[model samples]
Target: MDHYSFFDRDLSWLLFNERILMEAEREDVPVMERVNFLSIYSSNLDEFYRVRMPVILALNKLAKGGKQEKEDVLLEAQSLIEKQQQKFGQIFTSKLIPLLKENKVTLLFNEQPPNEIQSKITDYFFSQVMAFLQPIDLSETGKNFFPENNRLYFLVSLTLKDNSKKTILLNIPSNQLPRFYSVSSDDQQFILFLDDIIRHNLHRLFINEKVTGCYSFKITRDAELDLKDEYHGDLSEQIEKQLLKRDMGMATRFLHQPNIPLHTLHFITEKLSLQGSSVVEGGMYHNLKDLMGLPVSLPGLRYSRWQPLTNDQLIDAPSLFEYIAQKDCIFHTPYQSYNSILRFFNEAAIDANVQEISVTLYRVASDSRIVNALIGAALSGKKVKVMVELKARFDEANNIKWAKKMKAAGVEIIYSDKALKVHAKVALVKRLVDGRIKYAGLLATGNFNESTAAFYTDHILMTANPFLVREMELLFVFLAKKAKTSAGYPIEFKHLLVAQFNLKDRFLELIDREIENVKKGLSAGITIKLNNLEERVLISKLYEASQAGVKILLIVRSICCIIPGVKGMSENITIHRIVDRYLEHGRIFIFNNNDTPEVFLGSADWMNRNIYRRIEVCFPIYDQHIKTEILKIIDLQLNDNVQAVGLNENLQNVILEKHEPLIQSQQEIYHFLKQEIYDRV
Candidate 1:
């Protein structure tokens, strides 16, 4: 590892956010969609400060040398973020504002209304916003004024009649009401921030006080929870207790308006004990994530709606199990419908042949149809077991609630081992076929949550392959018996790559095989698509292979630490990142085994957490047809020029220049899968 130089993970993540910002800068994108990109950039940055900043802070608390190293990284990350924030402000003011004006929509930012809409704004503020206003005197609540995580607040500089100034912290209530209030005035549509509405009616709230100034601010607290594996108490209860403590965590970021007077800023920071926090100067609006919910409806302002296509195989089959039993089927989500996944659970619940079902629940939707189907199966007296990962950060409460519901419904809910999270997205169904036991498995590169399926690019393989399904059953049995056995239980997997056992070594072996092929003067190439690639062990292996002349093409969506195109280190490795309408959430790895390629897709990335700290699975694409389709899809993404950017040595997203034929991978893949439906018809 010392022989390799890696990019800082935090800095690399900022570069990824910069790519999302670049999408807003693209002129070809629809105006509203560009606004959505800005919202995504803002939302991503907020999460980074909440989650990743805490890790850096913890590292800084270590010995002197480590403290200095982490402090430097923190400074670099902050500098990059400041630059991105500046670009966001420029894009919003220069491009999006003017575009909205041209489309007969005006977003009023720091400007007085043109006298016609002032009355309407005042009326709306007094009626709607006044009730939610509860300003706390910071002088009274000093050091205990807990700014709830990620919520907007207005720090008011008030002057009383006696000329003594007092500061009040008021909640903006953006959570309770819409961030953008729409006002229709004589053929001209206008959108105003709820911040401005509150600003306009500030005098009404403080009757005797003279409001000298008001500035917007937001606080992002550390969101990481400390849930120890006590082995004595219930894991769900531990998680519930930690979720309550999330709001009381250390404040990581305090973002305030740039125009705040130095004295006011000092007062707020000192009173709130935010002396060492990352205090950032931002625009008048702090949480621009609200921009995503902008209430404006205009023709062609948004991306053309794309409906997920129904899979022809599932549509025509008399039974989903029967279809899967014949051949392996793949569903590329959002492009192809997720109904096939729903059908898998629904048919298993009602089909008399299904005797038992096992699934891994990571992040389930609030109103999960899959959970309903599992409950139905339990009510039907089928043996149902679920391994719900309760430590999926920010999704713990929802998972715990669903876990209780499933347990009450007689579903055997297996809580994840506190030491290892079950991040694998797999569901296994055991059915009695022809008086013998048979298995059907649904393995995917993403969660089983259907809501995310509508907007995430993932691949699900439905296979009744005896070898794979049997291995899946073995894995489930291991999970069911995990608590009873010691942590060192030897669970061997032959066909599938299981993390903590052989996934990491198996990947290394595959890469080494490519290196061996290159040594033998045989053709060797590696193509991988994953959300994050930060594990140094595998990265060093890839660098080694690159030196051996094994061409490596990586499509890493976020947090890639490996520096590509560096001489004597990773000169042959090329990294591309794709940020578009749908999140690129799938993990596909391909190795040219002496020209006969081996393709594998699964629920694991090369990140250390996924490889070492979680129960993940990466199964081989054994079926030739499905394998070819996966390869073709990866090829399409590799050749994409529309939404893909090359991650160069300088950590800049270099967009590939368009040739005669412009390739947008998502659209092309949709049409390609749509053609599959036509071919089947």
Candidate 2:
């Protein structure tokens, strides 16, 4: 048995968010780019509260039978979140806002603006914002006021002539209109947030009532759902109906401005029944995440956007299938256009020899060309089987809509069985080649989304190997029946490891080999790149390997619970996180077994949900050229001085700034791919 120093998952996620916040504070980043990072941090935090925080809260509520150290984990998570929030405030106030001012962009309050700026703001508010305003009085009735989640609201402290104060709420119409409005003053340009615009017009909103003072605040609700077992209708419908009511869910965090009167805050808190640890006090602005969606009209306020380069093989091929048959091709996305994926589906749909197609759909774009191709294939008499995962949170509604479309188009749709959520990104096509059965498939590390493909670094393997394709065929058969996958799909698979059967044990066995090799005084090492690392068994095995003198290099993008560089424990392990132009979104594992390097890529992360609950596949890279390319890419990312964070024992995001030449991997990868295409041409 191996022992490991495991950081709490919540704390690990906070570290990732901290990295994003650091980007917003970086002077090298453009003003708009910094704001975008801020937005990313805020949005990522929202998902954390909605998805992961609920689970932690639930675990804390469980009896002693729950995880043994539940309270310890929850308390650590709460404290960590609070501390990060303070950092977030400091960055926004001390760094970002000041930079904006230096650039002639000002987020002004109503207190002391120049006369002309104030006049312009008042005019703009009356003309554009006043029509959308609807203020509600919270004094006479003490009614429980509810604002939509993430919406900014002002809790006005109205004082009559008799000096009696009453509270009222005014919601800023930011969702419908622009969050920031730019105005001109001589040679300087000014930008004001929509919240401030509402603040400037507070007196006008309450004409008959005297407005003594106003303060800004917002509420964040505990947005989790526990589906009841008694629903008789479709599960998708039940979930959809429940989601409609998500806006009015129980309050999780009530964020109030620090300047709000104690009496007013207390009365509102008591009336809304938000007692206990749910209330959080903070800055004047509520949703800084809206800054992410800020329009970029200024000439040089953002980084230069790069257009996705097309693959040489895809661009020059006479036909997608014919080209794919020649050799295995790998696509590292955002650098290489995802049009090849759309082409694969489009070609398969029209190919008369294609008899059946089976694919897993987790998330898809709204105007998904892939869905259209699947429908076309079904209409053309090909058997199209789609396993639409309607449980993909925040995307459930869209998946449900697409599911109905696929069903209506004569495609056989297999909604995942309630127990498991199918997250594999494998696509299988059975075709007749020269009067014989053949299969060509594409396995991806990300979704088949065209929109996200431009910003997420993902991997997609296109192959025609019968040995691998046969196993994919068996996977489809097994998905249709909810049975344990067969043990005999390809008994000689010296490479690929499929979960729910032998993947976990296989991973452990591989680590043991590394451990054994290190004990024999051989050069042994392991390098892993993943989205998360939270599974205990895997972490323990890795720790054991590290203890046995294996040099461990980890590139974990989010939620890494294993702490590194601790004496007598994780001294051999080092971790890095990259947050840059594109999201680092692939999983790759390399174990140096006595100088005979073994590499694999696939859908499964080291996370528990992926290993135990979901169906995933990790296939070894058998092609020497592809393996070299992957290693080169990894090396480039490791050398990145920009947008990379080295994790400390305390998991502080220490920027890698050792005076080395700057190397941003995403940019370098794009140049590499573009050069490859040019050479082929």
Candidate 3:
């Protein structure tokens, strides 16, 4: 109820998520894609429960101990989510299902299985689904029936011959079977939830007992892993132990289908030892994120794929290494193909001249071609060093899997201190050309994983700049030693802004420069694009710059904590939140140095985690062409009316009024680059 200088980040995050729901509401959006938006909204909300809900619950209890600002925030978040869920249901039933039916696709939402498909559904239930079902009676199973976090389960009530009541828990094997079953009859397609198929055949499984009622429910638990400030043994082993217990964590949410009998709800809650505060009422579907599994059968309703553009210059180049050796280049993915980035690592693996390669991977793809290249590079006798952060949340298992594979293949594996995480997306390849140690570096705003690169918009700079490449190598050296902190390390990063050492200070200095230029009556402005903005010190400095008359512009994709456009404090500041088809993942900062603009891009988000807890790299853009292209892209985003929601002082998304030549930044940026790749690259 009270206004603070900064908005609560969690509350701001909830608003950003609501924007996804807004996309789903747009009539112009294709119906199938709209369904995907709904899926994303559900997926994002589930993750919010797993990751942030625990903190909210803890802080609310602590609020009782007098922090007191938000038990208010906790209640507001719950109420907001409740409203969003209702709106989600309305869209699903009234709008989306009607649209689907009009397109000759029946989603079979809350409705029963059509009589036509009953035989087929029953057959599949016995032949395929029955193998995965494990039914446990609550009375007989006693304390052994534990629900895994976020997994869907049906609580079925059965009536016995003796008139005694029984509750049974049936697993929804969505993990093993398709979440939805598609069947066609009378020229219409019906999509059935796997839950319904199993629910329909409940009587067959229970042959004698009458199937009285069935309700869906799932428990979301705290996902936090507690690692000591210092690890005494293997960090991977310690994390593996914690991961086994992750699903067993205390319940943060107990979401159930609406209108279950009160006694059943109470009995289940009591049996599970679920907190009273954790109970949440929901529609029939618990994990609607599985809606993504729905078949996209209509060609007319599907988004016309934008073919990822090719860097024609590198297409026929004899060697990717030699291409970078000629000049510096910036590669954008999903707009520009990720193949060039892939070929960079691929080339290094085979080139006889290449001697060593080093890269820091925060999150590696399950089938990472880059990691495979590293394995080949090591197999070919080239020295390879990789710092795989096993602490990348939700990605620890995949990263550990790759790390062990690389390690087994003789690649040197380096792990950061338990207290610190390596969040940098960078790589260095060294070659012996003409008896000289020649270096080429890969610096990007996203991970090296090609899986995410397909959808996440990120910038990768491929350069042979010795100063920058060598500076990157120094970072790898720091990781090789496994220094816990920057307290004793004396690496003066003149070009790279690395966290725990110079990143925070360097950013402050840049903001100070803009503030001083404003005082000198010169052209002064700052433009930054970040995924999140929560570091208070930097935000305060930006607030100071705004008061000093520096025009500040921000394009933050999610979780902005700073209060923008407030009188005197931030009157000269404006923030835009953009959500669209492709994720806007690049982080770019441009400061108008009087007249000439300076650009920097990297992995850091300016959040508290990035500023103090992780090793992030934000590198300067020295190439004139690269700087101009980045500025053009940012300029388009800043001017965008479509897909851009400007945040008011209250942290509400106010749609930008459309102007002449309406620009959707993602679509326009792609065309702009596609045109350039043909005209200039």
Residue 217, model 3: Cα distance from true site in angstroms: 0.5
How displaced is residue 276 in candidate 1, in Å? 2.1
Q: Give the alpha-carbon lDDT of every model.
A: 0.90, 0.80, 0.91
Steric overlap count per candidate: 0, 1, 0
Query: What's model 2's lDDT at 206?
Result: 76
Off by over 4 Å in 3: 1-4, 67-71, 141-143
lDDT of 1 by residue, 1-681 (tens): 798988888889999999999999999999999999999999999899889998876676663566454445776788889999999999999999999999999999888777988898988987888899988887664335878999999998889999987888999999899888999999999889999888988888899999999988988998988876465678889889989999888999999998899989998898887876889999889889889999988989999988889856568889999888889899999898899899999999999999999999999999999999999999999999999999998899999999999999999999867878899999999999789998899999999999999999999999999889988998898888765332577667889998877899999999999999999999999999989999999999999999999999999999999999998889999999998899999999999999899999999988888887898999999998888888889999999998999999988889898896899999999888888778877
User: Residue 314 deviation, candidate 3, in Å?
Assistant: 1.9
Residue pairs of candidate 2 with colliding backbone atoms: 222-252
Question: Would you list the rank order by TM-score, best first?
Answer: 3, 1, 2
Better-scoring candidate (TM-score), 1 or 2: 1
TM-score, model 3 to reference: 0.98
The whole-model C-alpha lDDT of candidate 2 against the native structure comes to 0.80
What TM-score, over all chains together, does every model reach? Answer: 0.97, 0.92, 0.98
Q: Arrange candidates by lDDT, descending.
A: 3, 1, 2
